[model samples]
Target: MKLMKDEIETRRTFAIISHPDAGKTTLTEKLLLFGGAIREAGTVKGRKNSKHAMSDWMEIEKQRGISVTSSVLEFQYDGYHVNILDTPGHEDFSEDTYRTLTAADSATMLIDAAKGVEAQTKKLFKVCKMRGIPIFTFMNKLDRQGRDPFELMEELENLLGIRSYPVGWPIGMGQSFKAVYDRHHKKLELYNPDNPKDIDIISLSGPDDPKLDEVINDEGLVAQFREELELLDVAGDDFDVDLIARGELTPIFFGSAISSFGVQTFLQHFLSLSPAPTVRESTIGPIDPKTREAFSGFIFKVQANMNAKHRDRVAFLRITSGRFKRGMSVKHVRTNKPLKLSQPTQFLAQNRSIVEEACAGDIIGLFDPGTFRIGDTLVEGEAFEFDEMPHFSPEHFAAITVKEALKHKSYEKGLQQLTEEGAIQLFRTYNKYVEQQIVGVVGVLQFEVLEHRLKGEYNVDIQLERQPFSFARWIDGPSKALATLKEKQRNLVTDREGRLVALFENEFQMRTAQDKYPELTFYENSFYKKSII
Candidate 1:
């Protein structure tokens, strides 16, 4: 089957990546406003009277003023069905951000004018580069005094190994910020902070339009702006669509996310330039987005306790091809069984509505009753699977147990749900009779989140005892070798999936074990091998 060209061209999906405090959430709110998805834009930092951002729906995010989990939002703008993946900017949750990127067709890189490119941005950019996804740069917070435009462009090239092509140029900085000069259209867009949504567009016959002089009363500023524009035209990289599509060059736009300046222009140009959903790689081969074959998609994220009142879980899926309808039955590629998807929902942050139908490039959530996991594939025809998603190795370890015997059931249930959600990894001692559990995480903040959720959502408290181990490896070998190794190693355990593992205090300890047990093999990630059904 083949999809109509018009239907395929109307869809766009991308993710936003940025560093902490870089106004990523603010940009998301403003984009939603332009799309008519929301009537009033909400601040990321919730106020007594103002609503919080639609994308940061978690209670923990509202309380902490930072996104801790990835959120998928879909809306309509300019006759395009846009799917936005808003990722966590905090370095503590880089794993979540990495997983979210796997589902995006392209990425928007947000850089603060004050801070050129922070540590987290570099890490995120490396992932995008590795995937060879096209990236668009938005220099945010131009209303504040920041680095020179030339310097910022130079930094992007020097650090990220990518060329920058300025699609628009700023007139001035901070309080003196007046307007942006559109290089492509050769026009000036006058800024109005008091009414940022109302932009006054003026055509520029040339740099010496008398109307420009009237709008820019500051003679000195106008002269300086003209000189900069001339310099940029002469020295900047030419706007090459081929280079941008290849991820070799990024078009730059300057704006203030809070005041909505330059946001609408950026949105319009982005929609016209960005690519629609392309091809996805699977075990069978590459799956084309334009194909109208039986529906197929994979789960990249599994969230539990989305509705705390109901204690529900939702698995987020990105449709790769064909159309999806409510009450459709799809084969679970891993389990080799058919599942009737009865309640597929679309997200407006935490507020969700049932989706009657969706198509390729769209993201929708399916209700999961402990039957789904990240990386599970749903298909309607012959069985096939996508490439396995990366499972990050945990760097921190801890021993944990419930504080009270009476709360053991609730504690166990909470632990199982959270682990299944990929918040943390759970392991047990090889001695099956032992009741204590060991946990591993990429960061220390996960421990705090686990404690908060256990007490707040499950009515159970936990006691965490820090462990000296800094690394863990899953063991693979014969039963006799495993027994002999466990007998010699003091730190040996088994994961919830019943896989044998060993904990090491540091790199040296892990090396010693590898040398002593030459017959055994070790795996840093449990999902290293692909087992297709």
Candidate 2:
């Protein structure tokens, strides 16, 4: 079946985002099931740290029960081919999320019913908004204890400054949670968790049943919904309340992912209304290397997987303009290096297959081509220059010391391979001991994955100790002078925050400096402390 409708010319790609453990993984599994991409949803808790959970691929991630990396899953939905970037929710893995957000046209911000907006959720949402991507809120886990949808909706509005309307309400929550009625379909679907096949649908639009009205009235929710309906009618399809006001069609659906309660209904609504990728205002560029005048594709990330004798390194790219074909050579704007494509592959979780060609608005993986790096642009012309890849300065740094360090040659080779995958940052200072830092968006799960890959793949057991008086200091002078000063001050004090505060001399700078800096001492106390030391 065609993934997109005949009339729909654009593709729709959405990224699922949430705080860690907000059931983002569960939602991804359900969507895959609805599309028949997977026969059964994998339970994250039951699987080995490395094997089962679709998103939790790294060994440490599995053992620690966190998502350390991002995974892309493409499937056909409604009339559009939807590519869902399931991203990691932890802070440590936020860099991955940031990069993935750039790859998506739209975002589905997931919130836990029990835990409304979290730190990671807030962080990723900002990235999406900054990119001007339209977002839809998915308030999940109604069956679990925590905040309710109404509260979450308000929090989202206040915290994120986004205007959203709830498309569905929970039928029941906690223990009595069962199913939800589609606001659009007006049909109630009862959930049968033990036997998912036993789904029952009922229309509640024109029913005169006393029992139904009684339940609605008792909850004081019917009047609320009627008000909502009136407001929606006033709001209209143009998304402007004063203009067309065609009435609100953002139907909300409810479901329990574990029991597959409202999975089918959610999928049906998602397919019916979610816009395709082509409808999105995509960035355009040329593909020809010589004319570099045209739009080209940008590679966001790369992953290496051992399949057979031919191990594959996949480069995930978004076409800004032009078309890319298999076996074509394109120049990377960043490195001034040309990469020959073996094939272009699209992802379904961990599985990837070759595609004939890719056009603008497509996000697919290009197969093994050496000399590829994240944020590299694939352009046709040699002279054309595209924008640099989005900058992500690592905020958190954990210096790892190997308990059983590898041989020098092995260590160098392994670190090179690891850094190329954007896993960690390794630094050597003459004064500070040699250290390997796992730097990126951080989450508990992300760190776990780094640990696993380092130990299992790199054959190194390591301990991470906070660096002594860490500060990313830059002198407001020449590079030579700064380097000299850095060397002099490298071991002066363990007060990184104070050092930075002294440099910036701003309140915001001091506040942020203290929050992130582990060891801090006020400059005023420096003299007294120096004398005491």
Candidate 3:
């Protein structure tokens, strides 16, 4: 009981978000390196003989050297149980990234030194801001020749509409990159990339210490470093924990993730300052982590065949209240059924170990035999659903065709499992399931992954014919009202659950259909928030 509350206080669940190639995976590996989760860090993109990143466990991810799906990684550091959600940096997989954000209490926004704020960075940051989560900014790739730190800070305020306070500022960047000066400690931590773990710190009287000149050797570089530090001291925003908690101000740290410089410093400060497991919103209202006694949680992600040999599905559940113990029977709120949570495991990417118990803010994977879903709430005492996750209006659609008609079993199995995992939505032209299957996704890259996975995993090769349609709307209200609108709308499809969807080729067509069928309610978002029960 008391131990549960203490454990909850020490939990910090967060997600790392950034644009493609901004070093999100590299930063994630470095954090794991500091946490002692892995023996040595691996590169995001490696040679044929070299090892790929641990977080990117998928074969396609290994081949492309990019994270197209979010993976959960947990580790312990300095009395804190940290759960790191490594999300996809590619915009094509932004929908999966967005859903993962719902489970996180805070976010770590990684920014490239050269490209200040990118299109995908802006998009993910907007989602964080919308969720009102505290964001910690890390200016990565300082080992490479990049933009001025001051310019990057200004761009953050001007473009992202957020202020920043640098806790550790870089002494130099690119090949001349030396180290990060700890502003709070008034110490210059020397960068020793040769043996990064053997860190050396010099306690300075101040930034103007003459001893620094001898250590740096470069007089001009020392002068510029002191000047920048002086300007930042006098004019920078004051460090405010309250503002950071409110997502208004971000505490920025400068370092190169690949070199493993300034990572431990960042991790230490982040744990002490970042928010822990907090109150969760539910249908019954706020569920406080400390006060609620009954074990309850919600499924934010369900992935299939994480362990290829097992052929199983794992549901990633974020415990909202109380503690979960292995083999406990709990109410599956969606189905109004009871379930024995016998096999609960914690993760280091695909590798897993059975966990005896887990508390709030902890993510545990339940061996789900196709019984769990995203946003399904499980509870011990009472039943209530968490707020529904968004089902974005698809911007792209394609008709799927299996290469071998004889392999219908494998093809059907692949399509059903993928759709169930929320990777993509399946739709048909009529009420019949056999009618041309149209798959809709938030981005185009998903189509590629879909094709790749079906062939790779299920032994079913597929060809996707692109559709002319751009958007889909779920129909509501009178069926008769859709009669006239359906005549004008050539493509009226039925979604997986048999909901009528009017596929529009353009916004003009959507507007025209709306004007024609004023009585019918057309919802752009296809949200099935309610359960069958």
Q: Count the backbone clashes (under 3 Å) in each candidate.
A: 0, 40, 0
| Poorest 10 consecutive residues by lDDT, candidate 1 | 1-10
Q: Where does model 3 exceed 4 Å of error?
A: 193-198, 431-434, 483-488, 528-533
Taken over the whole model, the C-alpha lDDT of each candidate is 0.88, 0.58, 0.89
Question: Which numbered prediction scores highest in TM-score against the true structure?
Answer: 3
Model 2 earns a TM-score of 0.76
For model 2, the run of ten residues with the poorest summed lDDT: 524-533
Question: Stretches of candidate 2 above 4 Å error?
Answer: 1-10, 48-51, 193-197, 204-253, 271-275, 278-295, 305-312, 368-370, 382-387, 395-406, 430-448, 461-465, 469-480, 483-487, 491-533
When 1 and 2 are scored with TM-score, the better candidate is 1
Pairwise lDDT winner, candidates 2 and 3: 3
The positional error of residue 255 in candidate 2, measured at the CA in angstroms, is 2.7
On the 0 to 100 scale, the lDDT of residue 322 in model 1 is 80
Order of the predicted models by TM-score, top scorer first: 3, 1, 2
lDDT of 2 by residue, 283-350 (tens): 34423322222447777777765232354567788765556678887776656667677677887766
In the range 1-533, model 3's lDDT, one tens digit per residue, is 46778889999999999999999999999999889999987787653667889899888898899998899999999989999999999999998999999999999999999899999999999999998899999999888899999999999999899999999988888878787888888888787757866778888888888888888888888989999988998999999999999899999998878877788889998998899887778889999999898999999888987888877889999998888999999999989999999999999998999999999999999998889888899999888988888568889999998888899899998898888888999999963445899999999999989998888788888889999999899988776776666666578898877778989899999999888788988897777334375
